[model samples]
Target: MTTPVQLYVYDLSNGLAKRLSLSLTGKQIDGIWHTSVVVFGREIFYGQGILETRPGQSHHGKPLHMIDIGETAIDEDTFNEYLAEISQHYTADKYHLLDFNCNSFTNDVIGFLTGGSIPSWIKDLPSDFLSTPFGAALRPTIDNMFRRPIPGAAPTPATLQPSPAATQAAVNASPNPALAASLLQAVASQAFSPSASVNGTGSSAPAPATQPQTSSSTSTVSAPVHICTNPSSFHSLLRSHRAVIAMFTSATCGPCRMIEPVFEDLAWSKTHGVGKDRVAFVKIDMGVGLGSQVASEFSVRVTPTFLFLLDEQKTYEFKGADSSELRSQTDLLLFQAFPPHPHTKLSFPAVEALSSEPILFTQVPALDSVISKLASFVDGSSSPSETVAAKEKLSQSFPVYLKARFPANKGAQPPKNLSANPQLIASWAEATRTIASVLPAAQLFPLVDLWRLSLLDQPIATWCSAATSQTNPVHIFMSKAIDALHTADMSARNTVLVTLRLLANATSNTALVRSLLSAAGHRAETTKVLVSSLLHADASVRTAAASLAFNVAAYLQKGRMDRLRGDSSAAGMEVEEDGDWEVELVSAVLEALSNETHSEEVGTSFRAAA
Candidate 1:
């Protein structure tokens, strides 16, 4: 059953604003509007990040207007996920009174839930208030009320850190608390000042700092981790790390100077970010006081010598400064230390060679054509009032949002580093649902096509992948196309074509592939859809279905390979005993092969799946 979505509009100024607005601002304002979306039996509002309470239980007290916006097709989980994604932009530091205030937030939420904007009066109130002479004067005061300092608020160049995602992932996956904490510090340092060095690369170094410190408390820059100066500190690092590479050098050695920069780069690239607490790079100068002791203990005869230690034992030793050999040995050791899954060795050439890229339908059509199609669906007199409201809001807003996100020069593809604007995408999701519930099967292609391209954006793809089947836009629409197939309405072929391509594109994300192929209900739904569509009367539907089938097979093959290779983090984490899906998939492909006549592409896909 759909949940009824309500807008709880509160007056922040109590009754005083309504009474004093005419005297203060020369125009009568209803209230200093603060709104929350009331759905799933909870009232959600944005303030110091997204917050929730029992409806009418917030500090703002009971709402003045409990407006019936519309019912939402999305469940609590999906709505909450949407809130989390959007909340990144609505932090405490981002809040403003006249601009980006509570009303602005509610408008976004209302659009997502109902594909309808908030009441014009409430939305226009801030702009209307700002236009007044008295209200204009208070703008700076209002801005100051919300403005606050944020630590590490400045953007850092991304190239400083080797791979932030890899570093964070390693940290989380680490079983050792002390190691996790150490890696966590590295991540924090990178977060604040990515360009800052973690460990000192100077010839005469000091002991590494336990934690990074900046010049000032609020400074964006952070100090680098100093290289170990004494034998005691060197031994401490060796004990803590799984692998340690100690470089013995002297200030007078020209080769040492030549290789110092390379070592420093490796230290930052390997230890600070990607490898977590696994490997450490140490530099010691024999010319320095404590460095002579370390050099003598390691038995270094010449300057610019390297020792690769694993678990405190010297595994490999080399002399002279050959950067190429140093890199090769470090890579080899890292590989030996953290091996890839062995299943990667077993090559089934056809399926293995299949492109891992999600089959994206990225062709940009004229926006007018899409809007015109939507217009046809909603322009009818029989359309529901809520649908009409949603259509109006969507037609006005979506195209503008889409163009801004994907400019004309960029050719409508998802832009690099797409800003986190969950509300606009959520609004589109709701609008699609609003139209899909009423539009005929034949009319869904255009809307589905729009959604297909939108999924190329990582955030949107991630959100949809993480959503439940009931709430996943891809699944809901794909199931619609599958339902249409039961009626054998050939007119719905184009709808099926795009829907299949949408599924293929959605699988571009690993999480989506896991959801589609590993979850039992979703696996069954997808398998049935593919099997049924393979025998469709239209060759395009068959071909699209075949391509989707190939993607599914490739995903399963990858999972099996990962499992065989003993990768604990593989998407197919389930036991091999749950091979029922594999059997079913193989059976379906074989059946398709038996009956396939047209489309060489279909046969190619079949070969790949096999």
Candidate 2:
């Protein structure tokens, strides 16, 4: 038979030592050497020692002596006390002792505790542990000792590993053999702690011996939290449970004036939990103000931008406005803030849908005209076929006309009074009424054309301005227009590519433009189309397509990687589960277009029919 070697009690915590005593027998004997006991705590040290017995003594020898291997005096009395306690508890009958002689104190202790046997391999070790397998190998042995029975006791039944809750409780309890054994059993059965208890109980274990909390008030905040001023902070706030709102506005924004009352109402409602926990509405003025730096950090270019933040971070944003629309938006945001019940249907007034049909204008009127000449033209056209065709053409061209004719105060300064003009209000109402009248007939055509036109350079400002009106008709028209424009046809698709280009070049509509690209169906094109568009004559079209394609590809890759992460066999699993790598396709196209060998810059503008 192989000679017995030195014993190791590796990685022994108080709970683990107690568990070993309760579970094992014949663990202590003369001539056995105990070495390398790794204790994970404030102090990290090792001990070298030997257990000696008389030469003629049999396995049942009465006398045993512990000799320190190191030159320094060993605390033999303390060591003997611990051994006697373990021996009396564990009931080790006959065992041979060996002198301690090993590089690692931990390995020796583990070897002794686990019957001087070592497994051929250890599996699934953490990276740090794998770097030093000896330490890692001992963890399982210590773990196994807690799972077994002593010599005279009934063998512990084979069972699943202890649950996190049970293990935590065991670790937290005072070091008593019986208590440790009970805790280990509880952990194994997964009945250690209740869900609420687990969350409420601070860390995995009860407060350690060194640190104890008498009450909730005694606990100190972990860190000094600081608010972020960028888009990342905005996202973080949205995800936070804390109630707060980050309002972004400019001093001279007209729409901001119209919506100020609504914000005040929101703030008031929050105080009563009418909004719950009373929202912390932090106003960040985009104009010259203390928050101007924050606005600049987030690249804020538009005024009246209301960022609905939670916990002082941005969650949702609102810019420009119609009173009813803004009110409805505010209500929806409030609903999100409160959430009646998990299963309850969320309630908020529905905003008007986007329009699909284009407004036909046979005659171009002055910029300030109150009445729409197109309405009379549609009513009076003589030929039925001609009228229908002209109406269809007008529907197509109206968006373009609106885009081209929208006014811009290029050299004018910002308006002093940030309030809506009565004339502007009247014009919006009239325009809405005129557009609503034609919506039913316009539904027959694809709404993509209307959207395409609205995105055009001149029409974008007009569309935005008109859509910002609270008039029901105008809201309805803009909503229907947006709906129609949601999906694109072949020609309209190219026009969209062009529209993106124009918006990117203009730079004023940064937020609006980003929202458009984020909408559905925008990332569905083939790589060829995307790459080809990169060299298109229009600068706006090329840049927009390129940026969008990159973003889409990045989003897809991230989503795929995230999906592949939790499972054990994820490494061998295929990356594309559905075989639709839309992002990858776009990326390939971008790569091809960007390669100077394959493509060149084309200087033509995109001009597909609306």
Which candidate has the top score in TM-score?
A: 1
Worst ten in a row by lDDT for model 2? 217-226
Which pairs clash in the backbone of model 1? Answer: 198-225, 199-225
Score residue 571 of candidate 2 by CA lDDT.
21
The lDDT for every candidate, in the order shown, is: 0.62, 0.33
Residue 260 error, candidate 1, Å: 6.4
Q: Write the per-residue lDDT of candidate 2 for residues 464-484, one digit (tens) a residue.
A: 322222332223333443332
Predict model 1's lDDT versus the native.
0.62
Query: Compared with the true structure, what per-residue lDDT tens digits does model 1 show for residues 414-511?
Result: 55654534456566667777777887888778778767766665556655643445456787787888788878788888888888888887777664
